[model samples]
Target: MTPGALAEGRPEARGPRFRVVVETGPDARQEIPLEGTLLVGTQVEGGLRLSDPTVSRVHLELQARPEGVRVRDVGSRNGTWSLGVRIHEVTLAGEARFTLGKTTLLVMPEPTEEAAEPAPRTTFGRALGQSAAMQKLFGVLERTARSSFSVLLLGETGTGKELLAEAIHRASPRSNQPFVIVDCGAVVPSLIESELFGHAKGAFTGAHADRRGHLVQADGGTVFLDEVGELPLELQPKLLRVLESGTVRRVGDNAAKDVDVRVVAATHRDLKAEVAAGRFRADLYYRLAVVPVRVPALRERAEDIPLLARHLFQQAGQPDFPLTEELVQRLMGYDWPGNVRELRNFVHRVLAAGDAELPDTRPVSAVTAAEDLSGLTFKEAKERMVEAFTREYLTALLARCGNNISEVARTAGLARSHVHGLLNRYGLKAGD
Candidate 1:
């Protein structure tokens, strides 16, 4: 039986500051208040008693604090794991996923009275969100789409800036016209000028024929410059001239051709700092950022994770896949540093595994190739993925910390002994 909503306290005292959500097992979906030290296990005296066989009589203890919740494993035979790492005790300052035996528990701050009610999921073009951040962003996008201002989409990588750019173009007057994408970072530096502006025949070795650059190609439409911060410093003036004059001068050509194109640039870099560091031009930055809009990161809009996860799984051709409440709770607990793209990949990975319910903690680079999963059991594949991620993450961290074991442990939020144990388990040396 799960404890009641309010913990035993003075009659006039406010409600508990936190709640423990039982995500899986016999007590699945039960929300228990955390007034003080709450015991969880199979015992009848436990505040969160369960019928799950794997849970010990007195498995875990949780205490709620103003800052967060303190969780401790109380001599449980199977131990407890957060995300994917086993833990004896941890102070979780935010939403966290904990697994004991076959059961998953979510410890998080109690939702405010107003927040207890659900908000409708909102969609703008191909993007979907329901959080306040996204709602504000949608309003901004709606306003920006009505005008022809050179929009600058600012956000961390994988926050769907390009999708928003396309949304702007589709909603703008130039819907029928070409919407070109120019990946500034993907293009070769030497050819970028020729690529963006046009080149005449015999302009250079590769100019056997006249070529209209991306600006000309996108005339009467819009051009989305992904990673615009990667634009070469030498060509900044030329780009500025085009934006100001509405004309582009082909590389090695004296004449400038008229081009009526709107520009939408996106980047993860702070252009103002780039300008101060003399890496990017101040004038160009000002010109391109005529109307700046920021796409909120996934963690900033965690309320949308369950909606997004379900949508992503459906998009990956698993429309019938059961996204249990437990699965959604786990998904929301993760801080998706890689944002929506990472979440999409995780959905596909879960679809591939068929029975995976936990969030994939492995970095994007460590996600095993689909081809590699063939003929391998889920356990084997998961082991391989974990090993790859452990090596890659530790290797990067070790290099970043200059082979200092203490520094590595501190950076990774692990004890020195645990870090050493991992290094030893993987045959890695601090110096190596």
Candidate 2:
């Protein structure tokens, strides 16, 4: 059995902590203590009989193994028709369920408490990769959940921008409220203003009745303005005003109404260049980018491809199916310029194409495109990579010093300030 939902411990990385789920059997309810290893077995009217009675120093030793762990039959003259089974017996690593007689085991591993993080919804259409990048993305989602600031997501199309935006909304305090989504570029140029800011009755042709705008509908929650860079030049000021004043004015109405909503904007275009070209407003950019986050493209975070592919498949809502390691490897090696959204679509497409059969692997070809991206000029892939020496030195020092930067620096004949600067430069903090 694995473990259950848990808080992350240790500085696994500069990210969320994780735990695992393990199952003993059914009728074996137990909780993982905050400390110590978890054990589950039946209480024999007393405590465990062992040479070491170390329960005092232990955190928890909960065991309620099913009859499957020790199958036995009861005496009955009429005979009994009962089902007893023991389906799995693996050490704790991931979550799974096992059968044991009348009872079953449900093992769980909290690999990050990661399910809660929200992915930014993007206009991207392709996703590729399987590696640390996916983990990092989840970590980003976890971190974003702790704040309510306006988040500006930057990523190319097919990058799952909108997905992340919704994740943030769901993880936010306003999850229960309206999560209004609007495509700034999707609106026809002539109708963009009317669509975002509600139009009053008779405001314009086809304005038959008073209608609520996307901003107002998201009054108590979040407004995801995808492709925000496409917002018309004329509409920029009004949008900024609403962001600044928390008010949305209808087209035909002279008065403005107050609204309580968080604005999360996303666009692949470079806002800075857009501002310079007079295509985007600088003030609005500042207001919306209180927390600017760049969604790493598929190729950039390829390490997370396997996990993402698995998750995207699961997200398909299909029960009782798992992906194979071979398929996962093919996916992990791909270059996903499209990012997570692409991966989701690929999973959906694969499931639909082969009904989840392992043979049908068009998804593999889609990811092989990563090689294409990789072949591009070095300038094309502006990724930050640690030098081999720096990585080895840092790893060795931290391990030897028990992750103490001061101690490592002292032993290595380096100034603490320089070491701290290096750690900061490399995105390494204490514990990692």
Best by lDDT: 1
Tens digits of lDDT, candidate 2, 310-386 = 56666788644566787777676655433454466557767777643322223433434435546556665333122
What do the candidate models score in CA lDDT, each in turn? 0.76, 0.56
* Model 1 lDDT tens row, 71-107: 8999999999986898898888745678999998877
**Which ranges of candidate 2 are over 4 A from the true structure?**
1-144, 316-325, 354-432
Which residue runs does candidate 1 get wrong by more than 4 Å? Answer: 1-121, 355-432
* Candidate 2 global Cα RMSD: 23.5
TM-score against truth, every candidate? 0.57, 0.50
Hey, what RMSD does candidate 1 come out at? 24.7
Candidate 1: give the clashing pairs.
none
